[model samples]
Each structure stands twice: as C-alpha cells, then as structure tokens.
Target: MASIDLYQIPVKEVHGVKGKKPEELLTLGIASVGDLLDYYPFRYEDYTLRDLTEAKDGDKITVQATVVGVPLVQMYGRVKSRLTCKMMADPLFITAVWFNRHFLKDQLKAGTDIVLTGKWDQKRLHLTVSESEFPGKGTSQIGTLQPVYSVTGALTQKWMRQTLKQALTQYGGLIPEVLPQELLAKYDLMPRKQAVALLHMPGSMEEGQRARKRMVFEELFLFQLKMQAYRALNHDRADGVAHPLDMPLVRAFVRALPFTLTESQKNVLAEILHDLQQPFSMNRLLQGDVGAGKTVVAASALYAVVKAGYQGALMVPTEILAEQHKRSLERLFESYGIQVALLTGSLTDRQRRDVLGALQMGMIDVVVGTHALIQEDVFFRKLGLVVTDEQHRFGVNQRSVLRRKGLNPDVLTMTATPIPRTLAITAFGDMDVSTLNELPKGRKPIKTYAVTHDMLDRVLGFIRREVAEGRQAYVICPLIEESEKLDVQNAIDVHAQMQFAFPDYKVGLLHGRMTPAEKDEVMREFSANRVQVLVSTTVIEVGVDVPNATLMIIYDAHRFGLSQLHQLRGRVGRGEHQSYCVLIADPKNEVGKQRMKAMTDTNDGFEIARRDLELRGPGDFFGTKQSGLPDFRIADMVTDFEVMERARDDAAELVRRPDFWTAAGYTLLREFLQREHITDSELLD
Candidate 1:
C-alpha cells in the first residue's frame, strides 16, 4: 500500500473508529488528520511516577494500584453521576472517584491492574480523577508526561488520544519538515516529526518544553512571513497622492486652535506628514490613551490633505461619533474655507443624495460618517486620505472598500486601545505606528477609586451630588440582563434601581441591544443635560465624549478587562470639571485584585494594556479573530517575546532572499498562509 499523507486524509477514515462521525470531530476543529496533528495541547499533565500515600491535596499523581472492590455509582444532579471505588497497593489504600464517567464500571473490575492519574483531596478521602485505565507494558513509560487536549461535543480526551496515536503510528513517516534544517540547527530545535511525537508523548517535562518551543517558532515564523508579504505588496507601487506639506490652510487651522498642541502630538503630526508625502500610500496607525488628543493630530493631517486640493473621509464606528467629529471639524475648518459634510445611516435619502452629489461635484472638502461612507453610491471626488476611528470595530474588508474609493488613498487608522509595543509590531506590522504619549494642556486626569459592595451607597450618594452640581454621570453594568451563570450586575436591573433611588432626576438606559437611532437619542439627551444619569454597558466605552459627564460608577467592575476598564473610565474626565471613576466589586481572587489595583493606580491606558496582556495572555487582549492575529496555541506574546522577535527577524531575512520564491518550505508556508486567509489583505486593510 502507498504511504498516506496525514494532511490529505480525513480522520474518520481510520479503522476501529465506530462511534465518532465527521460532524462530531468537526466541532473540535479536527476535520482531517492534519487538523488533528496541529491540534496542540492547551496544557500538559505530569503523570510521572509518584507514591499515592505521599500526595497532598491538589497534587496530580500517577500510581499503580489494583482494584479492591466493585465500584458503587450514584446519581447527583440532573446531569451528573459519581462513581466511587477502593483501590490498593499492599498497605496503601486509595478511594478514587470519577464524575459522569459511568463507562469505568466495566473496565475497572476487582483485581484488575490500573494506573490512575488525578489530584488527591485528603479531606474528602477520595482521589478526584478523570483518567483511569489498564497499565500499558513499558517500565520507562509507566509514568511519563502526557498531553491534555480540549475536546468538545461527543469527542472525549481518550478518543482524541487514540485517534492521534493511530495517526502517528500509521502515518508518522509522511510528516514533512517545513522548517529548513539549517534554521532548526540554529534554533537548537528538533525535527518537525519528532517534535510532534514528543509533544504528544514526552519522556520528561524538558522534552515537552523543547517540542512546544519548536511549534511556537513555527507559528510565529509563518505569521511574520505573511505580514512582510502584505507590507511589500502595499508599498510596492507609487500610485498614491503625495500631499504637499506647506499649506496656508493647515497652518491657519492649527493657529486657530484654542490651546497649543503637545510635544507628542507635534512629533506624531510630523510623522504622519512625512508619510503623506511618500510616493506610495501611507498606511499608519495612530495610537494613544483616552484624552491623549489623537483627534487633533488626525484633524491636522486631514486639514493638510484638504489644503492639497483633495477630499478626505473620516469613518467612525458610531453615528454619534461621526456627528461629533463633523461638528469638531466644522468649527476648525469653517474659517479656512473648508466644507465638512456628515454622512451617516441615519440621514434621509434626500440628505444622503445631497451629500453624495456635493462629493461628486467636489463641493465637500471632507466627509465624516460611519459605515455609510462605504456604500455603493458614495463616491469621493478625489479621496487622498482615509481616517478610521476605533479601527478594531472595522474589519479589513470594510477599510479596503473605502480605500478603493480613491486611487490608492493614504490610510490613517486611529485607536484609543493602546496595544503593547511588542504586540503592536505583531498585529500591525504592515502599518507605520505613531503614538501620542502625552495629554494636551488643561486636560485633567480622572480620579479612580476601587470600592467594594459595602461602599455602594456612598458612591451613589457622591454621584447624586455630582448630578446636583449640574454634571451628568454614567452607571455601567457588565450584562444587559441577568445571567443564570454569571453573578454580575445587569443594566436593566441597575437602571430600575437608579430610577427608583433618584425619582427626581431623569435616568436613561442604553445598551448594545438598542438601535443606533435609540442610542444616538439617549446620548444626545445625556449630552444636552436632559438625562441626569445614563445607565449603560460598555457600548459607551469607545466614542461618546460628554464634557459634562463627570462621574462614572461601574458595578461588578472585576468582570471587565483592565484595558476595557481604562476605556470605560475615560468616558469621563473630558471637561474642565474634576471627574471621578468608582469601580465597585469585591474581587474574588488575586488576579482580579491586581486588575482593580492597576486601574486605581494609574490613568495610563498603555500601562493598563500591558498589565492586561500579562494577566490574560494575548488571546483575550482583543480576541484572536478581532485582533487579526493567529490563534497561537503555545506561544505567549508576553513570555515568548524574544522567540517571536527572533522568528520575525528570520522570516524577514528569508523573504528578502533572491531565491525566496523557489526556496525550500516556501510552498508549504504559502499554502499555510492561504489556508489561514492571512494574505487576503482584508485583515490588514
């Protein structure tokens, strides 16, 4: 028989597998042998040999013991079962229990030899285990490190292990090495096949670590190559506008500002200006904390583009934000003879037609809108620059559609979410990034407080006082409705409580479930001082800028990520009034306490983002898909920063080689990138 290629074979085709179906395995993302092989373990268990008598509570151990009695199975909850039994090794007696695993009754018979691996709870006098099976025939392999995979649906860990073992045994010879031998030697890495095998069944923890390191490098290397390829494609042509630097209109707009720009703003403005003058399109990312005056820097660049006799479009994620930007830009550009128009979904058909006609006639110098700008009928007379606020909310395809409006328009994307420096390079390697690190003069920092449930009444009283002083406040809840599983506060319940507590003041409710028109109306009411208090979720975390909203109270704040909490706190402290952010929660653990402390310690978004990455790795930072990053199985952007950097450098060098197109592993790397949709450009656009 011809040797089977694991990548080309479906997993269900293997013999002796009867119960598992294609759809069941697909739930765990294992459709083929390749998917199964790439399905790395989320964690490893040290099943190494250890004395059962010497084990402490919560210590994982593997002990060889013979069953001493028949197992007794008992029903617990509606969907739970417990099986208990006694196992012995001479003087050592272990009471082991398995939950919801009724199949063990047949395999675990009296006088049967077995190796059990699980944690021991001495107080309960039971060994809480998930795995128990007949001892395999191998002295050295009796207790070795093992892989614990995350299986779903009808697929159990045993099924995954058995399937993978069969594939490795039957088709291990066909596992090709994608990494070059010289690169492997330089990194002191093992062969690809050996690494995959050792990762599944390692003799020691050291061997597992080595195998994991090689896999991490492979993931990072592939990602770096894709990013470099995208960058080269974006900058390869000089088909974009080179807006002139010296313009009277831009100088006038800057001079007309009420306050002087900060040094950081000036430096970033210079950087953007340089990119605007490049022959190729400008793909730059402007990052800063809340209230860091990134808007002004973007406005400066847009002003320059308009002065160069080209139209510009600023796309915000929300209609209210688009309207706000329109107002701000109008005030700044009115005296400079620039016409700014707002185009949002909320606009009437006639209104949209008027703006679209004006844009086609070159009457509108700048257009600000939400996703409505990317509509088919919307066209720019000469779109030289494209600015997007909160870039994460917009995908690469949406940005590309807008970019196609002009002949390779220079793109400037802005975000208030301050990503860590290392991750920024990884997530946005194709774009030149400039950060505004300082707040403009006269902007006051928000005072943050971490409070427990005991202080809730006091915090409510303070918010009442702030409202009485002619200021508005925001009350944030994590959930829209009460969840059976989560103990967090809901917006509806909190909104009712606020209304009942303060019957004299008008309280408004706003959440993600509300329509855009409804959200816009509520925000307008709050901004116009009609609503004394706004009860909402994190929907207001992004672009609602109310100068009078000086007080913020977040219930069950520990449920939010540190960076998101920072953004929530930023909704306030926008005006001359001294603002306060009260975070109410009794943290359940040290990580929660640390997140609360970080919020209270500093108002810096970047610092909070870094700490968030440390606490919850890169996966939860912005979610793997939304961040346009590969869902790395083992590589942590925090702990593996050095490894990622090395891989990135090597990938860059390899891509620049003269023979890169025909190099070894080039096809495999390209195919992997294509499979992942990394080169689609929709992610980076």
Candidate 2:
C-alpha cells in the first residue's frame, strides 16, 4: 500500500460516503485521520467463528462457508419467511438462519463463499456475521486487518468497516505525535498511530487492550490536570472570615438532639468548623448516603454560622423542605431565641417583600427557601455561611451565584447520594468531602421487602391499616402511562385506581407536567395528611419528606436506581414509628433480582452507591465530560481504585517540582484548563 497525506485527504469525501458530515464526526472528537486514530473502540469483536462440525447452542462463532445451493425466500403463511439456508464448509453441511434481515437474499448469492458469525440457539443458528464482498482474487484471499467502525442507524457494520479500512490506509500515516518524548517514555504509552491503527483493526484482544490503555491514560491525565488548575484558581482568591457563631447556640442545638451524632458526622462537622474558622472562604462538600442524618449536620452548621453573630441561609429544592427546615431549626434553636424565616416562591408579593426586608435589616437569623432565596434583592446583613441542600441539583455555577450575593460567604453543600470515594474525588476533587456514614441512634433500620404485582392487594391492605392508624403513605410510580413493555403502574392509573378502591380515603396526584404551584398545593395536602395516600411519579423522587409517611410503596422498584430507592425510603422513618419500604417488583433478570435484593439487604447509601456503580455501568459511568463530570475513559472508579491513588501521588509530585511548570510536556495540561473554560478569573470569591 502507498502512503498518503492524512490532512490533505478530503474529509468531505469520506463523510459523503458515510452519509455524515465532518461536524458529526467532531462530536465524537474526530476531525481528521489523526482524530480517527485517537478514537478507540469501547469493545472488540472476536471473529473466531467455529467450524460447522463444532456448532453448539449459545455460541458466537464465525466460519468460512459456501452457499452451495440457491438462496430462496420462504413465504410463511403470511409472507412465509425463510428461517434456514443450506451451506457447506468442505466436509460438513451447516444451516444459516436469520430473522428480520430479509435483504440477505440479495447480499448472499448461490455458490458464494462467505463468512458467518453469530449465536447458535436451540437447533437454529443466528448470524451476526452478514459480511459479503467480491474478492479481487475471487474469494482466494482474506483480509487480515479487519476494521470495525462505530456504527449508527442506517449504517451497517459492513459499510463502516469498509470505509474505515480505506480511510486508514489512505490517510492514517500523516498524523504526528502530540505528546513530548519524555512524557511518552515516562508513561510507557504506545505510539499514537500504532494505537489508532490497531484499535480499528487489531489481530487480538491484547492489541485492543494496549490501544485502550494509551487513550485512557491520556484522557484521565488531562482531566486531573484540568481539575487541579480549576481548584488552584479558586484557592487564589479567598475572602470573608467573619466570626459568625456563638458556641452557646450550637451546644444548645446539639443538646436538643434526640440522639447522638455519628463520629463520622462529628469529624466532618469539625472539619467544616475549622474551615469556617479560617480567614479563607470555605468551599466544602458534605456527602453521605440515605438516612445518614445530613439534615442534622446541616442544622448544626447553620447554628455555628448564626452563633458567630452573622446570618445563615439554607437553600433547598422545594418549599416543603424549606418549611420543614425552618420549623425544625426554629424548634431546635428556639432556646437561643434565633429568629428563622422561610421564603418560598409561593409566598404572596407582600409576604416576600416583608421577608426580604427583614433579612436585609438583620431581623432574621437564618433564612431558608428554594431558588427564590438566591434572587439579587435577597440581601443579607451578615451572610457568613450558605448551606445548599441536595448539592448535586444546585450546580457549581448556581451555588457560586448564591455565594456571590454575599461578601464571600462560606459555602457548604450537603447530599445524601454517597458516591464511591474515587468517583467523589474525581467529580468533586476541588471540594473538601466529609462523609456521614453512621445514622443517629434510635434510628430504626427500615424493613425493605421485594414483592410482585400479585401482592398488590395485600400491600394495599397493609397501607390501609397504616393509614387508618393515622400514618400516611407514599406510593411512587415510574411514569404516568400504561406501557405494555413495562409491568410498573404509572401515577395516572395508580392515583385513579387507589381513589376508586379506597373511596373513603383522599388520594392526591402529582406529576412532572403539573405547574410548580399545583405540585406544591398537592404536596401541601399530603404533608398535612389531608390526603391519606399520595400516588405520584418520580417527581416525588426528592424533597417533600413527610415523617408521618411511614409506608413507602414503590411500583416497579427495579426500574429505579438503588440510590434513588434508598432516598425514597428515607422519606419515611423520619418519624418515631417503624417504616417499611416495599419494592413492588419481580425478579425479572439477574440484574433486577440483585438490585431488589440489595435494597432489601442493606440501607447503607455508600454500599448501595458502590453496588449501583457496579450494577449501573462503567462506560459513560458518570454523566459525560460535557455534563461537567470528571471523565474516566478507561479508569473504572471501582476497578481503577488504586490507579487514582497513584495518579494523585504523581500529580502532587509533578506540581511540587520547581521546574514542573516550565516543562514543555505540561502544555497539554495548560491547554486542557483553557479548553474547559476554567480560568483564574472564575475563582473570584
């Protein structure tokens, strides 16, 4: 084969053949042959098809065979589809049967020597191998460098594979190495061209593995550098060390606690206090699992801010939560005579003005509300600390907006989603993380059960009993429609059915389409127990936690993630009564059963998180880099646990060296920060 200029090759010509444009390819981070080579396959296909004599059920095999006879389409009574084809592999006779690929007749000609690789089930062999091309040497030669291109709708594997083969051969040689020699040797990464060439056309899985290692390291190393730079930018500009807190109030609030705080929570709270005590602004993340008492920790933090003779503001996702926090805090800090006010979107114009006025005038000690609290007019006379609830929902930009409202207010974010430590470090590495692993004493372990649709009546009867005893219930549905493919009952159907079945009881409904006011109204009725049963969709996935709602019935429980299920369960058991979480599901598959069993077996959010990651997936594990999550191309947070530790060590060493900043090899690190839009200017406290 002759060499060619990769950059000179008309990108439009190849994309024209693929029926896509260079821009679409750019979405996959491809612009030229060099880009194409950098793009590696997530997984590889093994074309080692078996011999016809060794065919077995459930085996994915490929074989070189001949359609010695004429190919005919069988018309099943209705069109009589053909299910089998007679083929010969020298000494053996084999059957090639496929479904839904009715066009194979035009592709596979009689006496045509071809290859078939697919699964064998029952007495039938399904074929994923539908490749057929006229050989230049009349089927006498087979290509050794088999290419597998990433595919999509209307584009077949055969077409993509062919396109990649031509493009790589004609345009792959011109790409140059971007990494410095010392860096390449230091990391032991394979050459760029070799990795790309072998990735698209590899002889074995080992070759594919080598290609992946090189690409993965490049992606992760760049990600780490970006995060470190962003953090440093923030640290450079620090402000606000207002002494806002009276120990008397904090001690009184803690003493009022019904149970002891976990040592982990205590340790984390201390860390936060220390940060608050520093002259530098505090930007910390408090992450824990469901039922880990993050609220109490938040309340304790709020007390510290108030005791320091400055106002504290807590922002939650919903008015119901904000009101709950207001009431809870007012009750806990009641001893210190701390005035707490609740501000919500639902408040009347006059009420909002009064609250905002009080806040600015320093009449309010702690202000709690939804996003409405972050409005520009909502000024704080002495806003020393800001605590955001469900931190993930409020992004870094949103939280920063809230902090910007004050003179460098300390920011403390709290979440019940206990991500794996590695993922936490990767995603939130810039923030100090504190884990609340232990639950407060007297917190009853929730009884979780997995039941099927057949057990609905018994479950409803139990719920009715609980309701009759003055306890409320939360019935969570996956959607609002009846899907034949799914067994779960939706909100529209569940609410109507429950109302008809229990006419004496009031049933309220909530869904995503409802206006915020409508949702708040319905939630208000349910929280007050005016609605005995609240049948809703995942809209109730978070917020509006009713302690009185002691029973949680989640239909199609297997459909929701474990962390989500745990959070929904957390809505209950907030009261003194024992709570039960019924996972209305069938053990449909191994994954479904495992998820259901995990929910039943444990209530630990961190453990549930690890299992969820293990169960959820690895590739595209965190949302994507586009979603502002730390990208882990090959480093599985679960599998590459030690790699992260080592990488962190390496990064620390690189930064500490005097000559590290001047090294030309760090160009990629500098460029990555600029590309990610993370700059020193963003660090303005």
Candidate 3:
C-alpha cells in the first residue's frame, strides 16, 4: 500500500468505516485521518486477568470462568430482560447477571469458557457482567487493556476501537515527526509513531502515562514557540518607540497622590518604566487584586507617555468603567497639565466628532473609552501607549486593533482578576507579567461567612443595621429574573423584598438586562449613598467601586465561581471601616461546598484563583474560549503545569538562537509551523 497524507485522507476512505459511521465520526470532529488519530481516549479500562478468589467487593476485575449450567433468560417489561448464568472458577462459583442483554443467553452454554469483567459482590458471590469475551470467539478483548472513547451520535465503543485500530495499522508510520532529534533524545520522548500507537493500545498504565507526557510536551512546546516567536518579532522591529523616562515628572505626579504607594505597586511600576525606556515596545500584563492599586501604576505609565510628547489610550470593557477611569485619570493628571477625554457609544455625534478631532490633532494627551477606541475614525497623533483594563473582557482582535492605531505603541494590559501563575505563563506567554498581590495601606480585610436560607432574616438585619450606621450595602443574585429551570433567587424579586424589609431606606435594582444609562443611574445613586441597598446580579462583578458600601449579601452563592465570588466580595472592603460578605447557599455537591469555603477562608485573589482553576478546570476558570487560551488535546493546565514550564523554557531557548528558522535541525519544525499557518499575524490574532 502507498503511503498517504493523513491530513488529506477522509474518514470515509478508511477501511471498515462504512454507512453512517462516517457521519458519526464527523459529529465527533473527526474530519480527516489526522483528526481521528488525534482523538485520543479520555480513559482506559484495565482488563488484566485477576484471581476470582482474591477479588474484594466493589473491585472491578476480570476473571476467566466456565459456564456450569444452562443460562436462563427472564423477560420483564417490553424492553427489559435479565440473563443469568452460573460460572465456576478453579475453586469458586459466582453468578453472572446481565440486565437488558437477553441475547447473551444464546452465546452462553453449558461448559463454555468465558472471561467476564465487572464489580465483584462478595456477599452474594455474584458478578454483574459489563463485558464478556469467549476464548475462541472471532475477536476477543479478554486479557488486554481497552480504550474508552467519548462517543456520540449512535457510535459504540466497539466500533470506534475497531476503526481506530485499522486506521493506525495503515497510516501510523506515515505520521511525520515534527520534533527535532535532539529534543527527542534530550527529553527521552517516545517516537511520534510509537507514542500515537501506545496511547490507543498501551501494554500497561505506565506506558499510557508516558505516551501522554510526550504528547503534552509537544502541544505546550509548539504553543510556547509561537509565543516566543511573537516576542522576538516585537523586539526586533525597528518601528518600536523608545519613550523617554521623565523621572522628575513621574515623582512629582506620584507625590500629588492622596495616599502613599505600596512597595509591590512601586516595584511593578518600576518594571513598566524599564520596559518603556527600552527600544522595544512594551507588551506587558499587569495583574492585581481588586483593590491592589493597579490604577496608580497605569497612571504613572500614561504620565510618562504624555510627558514624552505622545498620546495614550485607555480602553475598558464597559461604559461605566470607562467613565470611572476617565474621572480618576482626570483627577490624577490635571495638575500635570495633561488633558484627558472620554469617548464612548453613549456620546452624541457632535461629542464623538469633537473628541476624535482633538485626538487626531494632538490636543488630547490621553483618551479613555470602551470599544469606541477601536473605531476606524479614531486616530491618535502619536499613540505612544495603549492601556486596556480588564484585559480578559476584550477579545484578542479588539486589543490588537487598538494597538494598530499607533506605530508599535507600547501596550499595557490590566486585570483585577488574579490569574494562576501557570495560566499566566501559558495564556499570556507573549507578554511580560507584573503582579500586585498586596493591597494598599489602611485597607482592612473583608470578613466573610457562609450561611443557608435559614439565616436570611439575620443577614437582612445585619444589612439593615449597617445601612442605619450611614454605610451602604449590596445584595447580589444569580439571575436577573426568575428562571424556570434554576431554583435561585433573582435580582428583581430580591429588590422588592429588600425594599419591603427596609421601607425607610432606598433600594435600587441592577442587572445586565438594563440599559447602560439605567445602570449608570443606579450605580451613581448607590455611590452617593442615596440608594442604601443595591440589589444586583453579577454585572457588578468588576470595576464597581463605592468605598462607603460595607456589606455584600450574595444569594445563591454556589452558582458563582470562586474568582467571581472573590470579585464581588472585593466591592465592599474598599473603605476604612470593617466590611463583611455574606454568602447564602446550600450546596449539594463537594465542589460547590468547596467554592463557598474557599471564598470564606481567605481574601487573597491569587489563592482563590488557584482554587477556582482546580475546581472548575481551565475552560471555566475565566471562560478560556474568550480569554485567548489555547485549546490542547491532551495537556491539562492544572496537572501538567511542570511539563508546561519545561516546554516554555525549551521553546524560549530555541527561539533565542540566531539561526532558528535556518538551522538544519529546525527544518521539520519550520515546515510544520508553515503547514499549520502558525505565523506572526495569526498568532497575534
């Protein structure tokens, strides 16, 4: 047989994949032979032979036995039946029962030798057969490890296994090796062909683990290589603007601030200043807790850019956040003779045109807006700096488009949601990272507690007392309106309840369904203490600051992730007065309970983020689909963290070589990257 390109051959062309099987494979995302080969099993079933006498109750084991008597088939309902047979081992007799498998009666006869795999019930000396194989049958999977795949659309495990086996046997050798020989030898990695085969048909669990390690390393290595390549290209570009560091101006601006800068914030600002002075454009991510004072560091950077005779742009996710930042920045830089303007969709046509004209003509030193900053008509005279707040909220292309407004502008991305170190390196590998873990001085830790529905009255009383003391409070719900499928409190119902409970105080409602203007009005009232209790959904999860709000009561807290719960908790602790967070939930599962416990245990956002990653996995940690996190076929961000670090280091070293693309050992890697269209443009996007 002629060797074929696995990427070109369709699943239908593979042997034994006939009829609807081709369509079934398509539904599983197996378009070509290559995708089929990459569709690895999620788990494996160990069917190694075990002694029947030594098997304990509830232990899944495989045992060889002989049928001692005729099998009896008992019919129950229309489609339900039971097949029972007695099997005798060397010195033990066990009864095997197969529910809904009545056809097996024809296969089991007196004195027939069979191998059965299932849980052992020692009390009754019985085995519930999950799989059975006859010794002399046409094809037996008795004493071997079996691969269990995730199948759908009328696909069975047996059919999937058979088709994969045939495909591997035919095209396994033709699968090209993308990694260099030196790496393979240095890491002691299994060959590509051998690893692929072993993943599907490993001799033992150890072999399976080894195969998984090789694939994990490959996936992470390639991903990091692309990241390093982007970094290299950015550093080597000649269009990068080397912004002059005006230390005197920066010091004067810092001194004008009302509060002293924390040591952690100072160190992070130093790092950003250093990056700005370099010839290369600064592509950095600044991550901190909700009240960690990241805004000060960003303000300093923007001040440096404006003093250097260039413009800066600050982009945020929501209009409310944009308005807040603009007010804050205006207050910070007004003394330095720098002008800041706001641009958003809410602006009238005349207002938008005036701001655009001012930006294009070098009148405005800094512009703050939402997605409006990326509009085609929005141009900067010399866009020296681009700062995006809540970086995960914006898509990759959205940020990239804003960056393109300037000629290799120094970009600074900010996020209050602390990311795990492992995720930071993998997701933002192309950018330098600076973390601020310490909160500012005079900031007290928020007291947290978890309660059930029975404590609702006490919680409301606590909030009422706090509001009576001239402090504001927040009441959060999981849903904006009542959900038929989910049994959780909604914002509207809670708002009405709170109003009735505290008739003397004002209660406001907020959710995502409200217009931007309505939300702004509610938040404005809450910030001014007019609305003492604000009943809201998770829309208040990010960048809503009201230092007077000292109490937060979250309903159905189990529905929120740990990180999200942490963010909501941060809304209160901003004031000097002691703050509190009350989580009202009755979790039914261990994970939900753990999430609630993690929130009440500590106020550290990084620790909460780490726990959330472990509990929810990477995909749901922060919505990886929209966060620019790569999808790996086998690599897990939590379990394979060490392997990811190794891959990152290796890729960094490889990309630093001067002749990386032209080297002899890198030919295959280069070709692979080209074949997959992993170029600078695509990687950046």
lDDT of 2 by residue, 437-548 (tens): 7777777888999999999999989998999999988899998888898766889999988998789899999888887788879988988889989998877766566878
- Considering lDDT, where higher is better, how would the candidates rank from best to worst? 3, 1, 2
Model 3: per-residue Cα lDDT over 446-497, one tens digit each: 9999999999999988998899899999999999888999999999899899
In the range 611-680, model 1's lDDT, one tens digit per residue, is 9989998778877666676567668788888887888788878777766667655667666656656656
The candidate scoring highest on lDDT is: 3
How close is each model in CA RMSD to the real structure?
A: 4.6, 5.1, 3.3
The TM-score of predicted model 1 comes to 0.84
lDDT value, residue 8 of candidate 2: 40
Of the pair 1 and 2, which is ahead by lDDT? 1
Residue 394 of model 1, lDDT score: 85
TM-score of 3: 0.91
Task: List the lowest-lDDT window of 10 residues for candidate 3.
Answer: 674-683
**TM-score, every prediction:** 0.84, 0.82, 0.91
Sort all candidates by TM-score, best to worst.
3, 1, 2
lDDT of each: 0.84, 0.73, 0.88
